[model samples]
Target chain A: MDKLNEILLNYADVDEIPDSASFRKDLGLSSFDTACLITEIRTVMGISLEPADFIKCKTVGALKDYLNTK
Target chain B: MIEKILPDGSKVTAFPISIPQQFMFFMSAQYGAKYPVNNIGLCCFIHGGADLEILRDALYEAISRCDTMRLRFTPDEKYKILQYITPETEMNIDIIDMSDIPLEEAKLKLQSISREDIPTYNCEIHKISLIRFKGNTDGIFMRLHHFAMDAYSTGVFLRDASEIYLHKTKGTAYPKPMRPYLPVLLQELQYINSPQQTEDKDYWFRSLSEADEPVFTDYMLDNRLTQQQKKNPSQRFADIHSGSPEAGTLIFSMSEDESKRILSVCEEKQLSVCAFLSMGLRTALSVFNNNETDVSFKMIVNRRGTVAEKKSGGIRINYFPMRSIIPGDMKFADAVNEISLIQNDIYGHCSLSFWDMLIERHKSMPSDAKPDSTYDSIGLSYQPPTEHIQLGSSPDEVIWFNNGASMIPLYLTIKHRTTDGGFDFIFEYRKDPDPVYDLNIFFTKLRGALLAGAEDPDITAHVLLKQLKITDEERKGKNNG
Candidate 1:
């Protein structure tokens, strides 16, 4: 599994995971959880990310795309 | 009835203390009389082109406006029963000239002054003093026994004082007077004795009967890190003197933008800021203690606006134990939902007093089943937004210096300033000769967890445990070994 997917699976139901699934709406993730995800991505991907950056990526696909850019 | 008429023609009312104040009085008596347990001090710096005389008059006006400001507690014939007396006389405001002293010295003097304990045997319930520095800054100091007022009352007093000062200085009309606590206390007393209160007490009794014993003991005992310290020679030597603990406070703040983001995230998740912080705290404790899932701590809730409490303030707060069992395999979102539900249930019956809950628990459960008062040594409190009082057009900057002893082993107070929308986290902990945990690391981890949680709402507790390299089985195995 990709790093993002692995992190998401720990928090969200596997059945709920989809490329277009919204982290906030579909996954029911809190801001704190989102923050932890960003921190994990920073550590795993070796890049700095801000809250605004993650906040802009509403879906799993969007976040994945953003991570690729980094 | 009128206690006494002041020379200034203000009427004084004598009334019985509320149930909450009675609880504090009893607790103080039970704990020893050498030190006041819940005395709180608030000191703030005033920077503006303001005169000392005008500020003094404003302080006097504030005292006259709020009965709590003039409130005094006298012991009645009943043990630990205090009668609330609103003396009509003008409250003395001591003005000291620190104009020649250096700013650092002035601050040290203020700190020393704030730490001074109130003479419980005295007739006065509170004190207000001021210090004038050489620079444009002046200081307003207030020290009050918990029986006299609470944290909310401090805001009310400041707002009133500032309004009175503005009216005196700029000829602005003072806001309409708020109803005093005397009549409110009387009403509260009647309500507490009513059938509704009895029902609430029953609800609390049932809740306590079903509540689990605090899981903190388990975490403290099972954590490998704390256990490893037992082998250290210095730590073993210092443990002998750990009984007598000195209390210290650590204050931290987050910028406006950070606070706003966290708040917005909380709103998005349908969780209150208090709930979010509580979760962060639980997660931090869990991770710190080998990913222990069962987290328990008492959360102090303000009951001022609640039905059982008096709308006018004089110690309307209660501590309720918040217990959450976040399974190591549980998703973070699921844990948040579970906590939110539990919080809702607890808040529904929050009007029940902590003392009453203790009494009920002791009475309802067998000796072996009854939980001890070990849970009382840690608490979390969140201060709601209050009116901001500015000294000048630039807006008044007030920095709170807490000098009182910690009520618990660890008490965390989260306050959001209305003036700047910033967050202040004050962690007051007992400073023992042999500390079990490093508070600096604890605070840093908690803050990091909160910030990380806010940044990535999709991260599960399991993932967090993995990322932080925490393994519960390994920790437990070490403990067993």
Candidate 2:
């Protein structure tokens, strides 16, 4: 699993997170969960992203791509 | 701070208290230990069908796994608070079935169960129970000392417990373990003397020092403060403060649609809901005091910058003054944007102890001057929506019990309702007056201003005051029409 999925796994009950799964819709993450995810990404993945930017990413695939580009 | 072998063959190790913990002690001393100033009473009813046996096992598993559940507060001759983790086996869970009683009576029974406080100096940290309510649903009543857990951590504990319960019920694998608590504690201790601490101290000192002493901005529509001041000449201090720490709560829940409207506006502007709410509050404060441009209030900054701290359970709150001297001509949008910027700046330096800095500032005050407590009297804490556990049809049905005591005069906490992501404004006020009618009026004004500002960001705050000044009868007539 990627670092993103690894972090998501900690919060979500799912064993795996598909890149297509959107945070709020599919994964059932709350705004607070997304906020915590942003904090984790900053620490674990060394990515600096605001909550707004994260919200802009509609799905996990988009976030992964955004991080990869960064 | 020490390690010793008890005569009973139990080993005990002690850790120094954090700044938040120190503040809890300070407040408790002022409130008198009988009040249990740190106790937080929370009673939540779960709607879904949860097997009692399975839930009990899950509670055991969660307690065994989460180090936060093991924390105990014990003070020795050396320190006022020395915390240590107890064995998970030491936890005692109560299962109460109040189904036999009427709903109202059962609620009272549950409230009584949730209202118990941890002894002031003892290590008996919390009380957890599984209650069967009148509707055949299970309720979790928790009496947690603020020292061991905060609002965020309460969410974490419930989330984890639900996860464990699901894993057991569905025959799936147990979820990922929470980060260890000791490392987080040690990291906080290191921060006390670090470079970041120095920077934070300097920033806060500069921030508070720049603002002039703020006037009391009463949220009550009745102008309770003004009336009380006029009635008692010498008790003018009561106008700006609450003489007693005993608190009563007034909860005002906003509709899901209204909440969504605010959330949409926040997203469109790329603003945190907290900032928007802060601006709304600051605008109302200004409006209440003849459009007082210089307004300040204590804003809660939870130092959960790192994932470890965010995931772990403990109190790491830094309540500092969010001083805003808004220009009379500034647009509501611009004001909110400025508030958000200040929040971001302060959040960056949140690890420092605001309480310590506050004490230091007090020491610098003149001998005869009473320490101005205006900023703290009116405060706001916006809670981020953490992972939620469902016990009912809609998780928003959860009911919170009062601790019967509070440390502040006026505190407003904005929480997201889990059912539909709506807003729950819980106001904890001093025990003296029942501010329900005025509190409702205050929210109506704040909500109107917020909605109006969101609709037209360019609207100046001076214009927003019109909403605040709207007569209750007129507002009702407008609603009727």
Candidate 3:
């Protein structure tokens, strides 16, 4: 699986996430769950994303765009 | 309450006390305000060929013989909890039999049922079902409320129940309630006001200042008391069997030489085996936590008196925290001796309540923090060998509660039965954290520490490196062979 898809899959029990859906709204992720997702993303992408960075990215597409730049 | 004189001519006060109320007060307070509303009842699941009528008749007569069994709670005018003193009475037993249903499946159903429906005041003695295992005679499963009876008392009740059941089967009057826990309860109450109370209070204060409050959270374990909740049975069993690799019992089967070495160390230092073990564990855990400073947790006191006098056996089960400050770099033997002196000086404190300490120091704690932050550690208990007393029936092995993820995070319990030649070391992690991962780490470290202690009684932080010797040997063999 590609990096983004793998990260999304590990983040939720549900199999798929829509491109249009925000991570928090679509996945119903708690703060701890969100942190876990970020930690996994950092490890996989080898990028340092501060906790504050997660605030701007709401949806899968937004997160993907941000990750690609970093 | 009446005044009486002890054999030593010391004045002792006795109470025409409320037995059930006392039971309820202690149990509810001790077990965190959940289950067995009164906190002193049994959840006995008995199975037999006999129908509901036989079970009811047997239970009725059994409760009748035991007057205290019918004792209930009543509040005094002051509303300070008091027991309703009842005249010796025979009460009808409430028995529920689901024998017509399949046995194994019924057990699962009954176990799945929550306490929400059961009457809080009354104890449950469910007639779950009769078991017909291929190899042996039949047996029934039972769960008792801690408030009604402890393990020892429960065993007696079961033994008596069995005797009564057997006699009834052959058509005989049920035997009398053999031994009651009431006297023990009464004796323990005495300590509430005794010199022991002062010591217990002090210990509680110190422990609370150091430890933290119990935080309740969800446990990762999928094992729920619901029929719909299911996991692969084999996997569940495997997890339980492995226990936390680091957490449960760490036994050190001493070679004759090693045993003698330990004895010599204890004798030279005038320490008990239990005291020595406590110091060892503290040192090991301190190192595992990477504690740059020394810390201490509560240790269980059997409350049994010394050999010459029954000083310890007033039926009160008490534990108190005795702290020992370790030099960040102290050797193992020195640390062990430090524990011995601390224990000796504060042995009197064990009888005090750990609750008062937190209340006294509540101001120092963060106002926003919930209770239990005062102490972060729990007591470790050890039960010495005693002649097995045959209670109502032979006692089943006691199981420890899987205190799922916790708020306070860590508790360690060490209990052993000489009769059974078995010992258990339980580490309770605050389940509120990632319980599975925290426990996985905590148990592994604790187990390593305990095993290291066993191999070298005089183990120190410096000597911990020696524990890798086992792996080293394995590796060497692999290379040579």
Candidate 4:
């Protein structure tokens, strides 16, 4: 229901994304998928972020915390 | 292995062409690649109007995101043909204002250009123009080579562009970039000699290993084959070894209400629209051949099952003969189910190389056998329109353009009209005299047979075709000699 999860739903096929799940290994999120997520996060969440911001966040929890900090 | 510098100074590194691209080249080779046989054009007429600047920016972004649209090809070598996406080379889209001319005349001008080849060797393989076709009735016309894009990919590209335009105007979500096509192409290219290839080959070869060859039933039913038969009594079947590539289209549309009625009937009978359509076509051919049961035609399968294949923009069309046998006593509804079962089996192994199967069948044929003479005179496809609406354009305003050539005698495409979800039966056929008259008769008979069968599922195909027989009134009225 959250903005991040809502956008992630569009890209990731899996239903539940645990905070500890690996973005690349578990969800199989390719770099292109990550780029789309960044765009969606900006447009849907109305937050601007960089690719490096994604680098700092490994799992779902880290990405959520980083976005919330903004 | 070849490197060249594009005009944009981008180093063009070539990758091997995919199987679909190889099929395209094989067809194009017939005309020395001079004819625009591989062209797919779309002209979307925006209802109110579209800003050229915004649409142009949107087109730019769309093309940039969908890498296949930026493809360029090298001339075919005996062993290797290559294509590359020039990173810096951009599509030169012109905003042509034909507002002063009548819409029909403006369309003729654009269509003339579409018929010409895009100079595939060391050149950009697509072209586009933003046209102002009188007042606020403007549209974008795009010409793409089939080597790089298929009908499905065109829809993806158009939907992407429109979504980008909406984002610029209404502040909607920024569109997602398309998945890169190269990965999809690489995966498919590996299908050539893989273990899966051998399994698929076995599936197809065994499925079509019937003792008897499917008799080619000419849909033209114009008696050209009948005449040929009178001349060559020993000939196995229709000798449509020769046909012109110059094409014309005859479109029959079912209104939204009528389409809904038929769709409801199909749903109630638990029959797919495609199966219902195939039954009508094959039945008509069967009746024309004196209730001869066996009928076959090429069915084009657009291979896009996964998210990766769905989002990737490139041609993934595989075509193979679909043969069906309908006895005279078979009920129309039952026939539809029979065809559906066959379709399911075909779709299960539709990824197998069509050329390989053709070779296996024809390798031992007589030396004089023209490849075209062996199987089908018709190819068929059904496209469902599911693209979400955008661009502030009315659905009726969207127009799809034919690339002005076809190798097949007739290619029938039944697609849901995006505007009203109606069915448009577009018959793309070569320009030959007998075809026009024959198709005129065939379309009327097929349409009636389809609707009546849908309305009454219990009607036997024999009864349905008997009713749909070319009325004497039709024969007397406009049966052009």
Q: Give candidate 2's error at residue B211 in angstroms.
A: 4.4
- Residue B458 of model 2 has an lDDT of 86
Pick by lDDT: which candidate is best?
Answer: 4
Chain A TM-score for candidate 1 is: 0.83
Whichever of 1 and 3 has more TM-score, that candidate is 1
Q: Tens-digit lDDT track for model 2 on B412-458?
A: 99998877778898998877655556666677777777888778888
Local lDDT at B20 for model 3: 32
| The candidate that achieves the highest DockQ relative to the unseen native structure | 2
After superposition, which runs of candidate 1 have C-alpha atoms over 4 Å from their true positions?
Answer: A1-70, B1-13, B30-33, B171-173, B191-193, B211-214, B217-242, B306-311, B328-334, B362-377, B392-395, B417-419, B433-437, B468-481
lDDT digits (tens) for residues A7-62 of candidate 4: 77666655677888767657655433455567568778888877656746778888
Ten-residue region with minimum lDDT total, candidate 2 chain B = B233-242
Arrange candidates by lDDT, descending.
Answer: 4, 2, 1, 3
True contacts kept of each: 0.00, 0.00, 0.00, 0.00
Each candidate's TM vs. the true structure?
0.74, 0.84, 0.52, 0.83
How many Å off is the CA of B95 in candidate 2? 1.8
Give per-residue lDDT, candidate 4, residue B457: 86
- For model 3, residues B1-481, the per-residue Cα lDDT tens digits are 5444433454534344323334345545544433333222223432223344565555555554443444433333454433322344433344444545664564454444422222323223222223332222233434333333344444444545555766766665545324343555565567666765676655556555566532111122222211112442211011111122122222233244544455456545444556666765664445433342445565655443321111111123444545566664566666665665565445544444545544654644546435543233445655432333222234433332231222133455554432243445555453332244434433444456545555555666655634422334433443454
Give the TM-score comparing model 3 with the true structure, all chains together: 0.52
Is model 2 an incorrect, acceptable, medium or high docking prediction? incorrect
